[model samples]
Target: MSVTRPVAAQFEAYNKRDINAFIDCFSEDFRGYRMPAETPSTIGKSALREFYISNRFNNPELRAELISRTVLGNKVFDHELIHGISPTPLESIAVFEITDDFISTAWFYFP
Candidate 1:
């Protein structure tokens, strides 16, 4: 199925491991958060990039597949497979808040 440009671009950039392209999908002040253990949110695109880089290095086979998505207004919600890197079956929800320019502030949460 065909989705919005930004959504497709984000997925494409991520699958390719193109950091610049991935960041380009977000605004300059873009930020992200996750509820790993009830701690503070992960803020800023730079910090988020660092987190992803660390994960990628640690899990060389890391991969994510978009299982489903729903878009309403400027927000998009995605259900995805996160542990596919390990060929495992870990699932999570990704939330994307799209900006006027199609940039996004993303977040993830376990279900």
Candidate 2:
């Protein structure tokens, strides 16, 4: 299976704020992190759900549009972004490590 399909599905869920659907795109042992300081990693579905909820509450109009997607074996590098609050959009690069079940890991960067 190509990473594009899963990534696209994730984007769909994210746009809809469908937490169940969004988290479904991740593996059972999924872990994610935002760069700069990575000591405390977000592990498991519950943690990720909290992250999404907080984000949604903070930025009600947040939405990501894929700028580009590159697949390398089990990994997918997605350059995308969120918009609506500020004039200039916030850029993000999601490094997705996919597994048989779902995406195992994600590392995000904003610059």
Best by lDDT: 2
**All predictions: root-mean-square deviation over Cα?**
3.3, 1.9
Cα-based lDDT at residue 30, candidate 1: 73
TM-score of each: 0.77, 0.87
lDDT of 1 by residue, 79-106 (tens): 8886545556679887788777665567
Residue 27 miss distance in model 2 (angstroms): 1.0
Worst 10 residues of 2 by lDDT: 55-64
lDDT, candidate 2, 51-104, per-residue tens: 888867356787888899998988899998777546888888988988884788
Off by over 4 Å in 2: 85-87
Model 1 deviation from the true structure expressed as Cα RMSD, one decimal place: 3.3
Give the lDDT of residue 104 in candidate 1: 54
For TM-score, the strongest prediction is 2
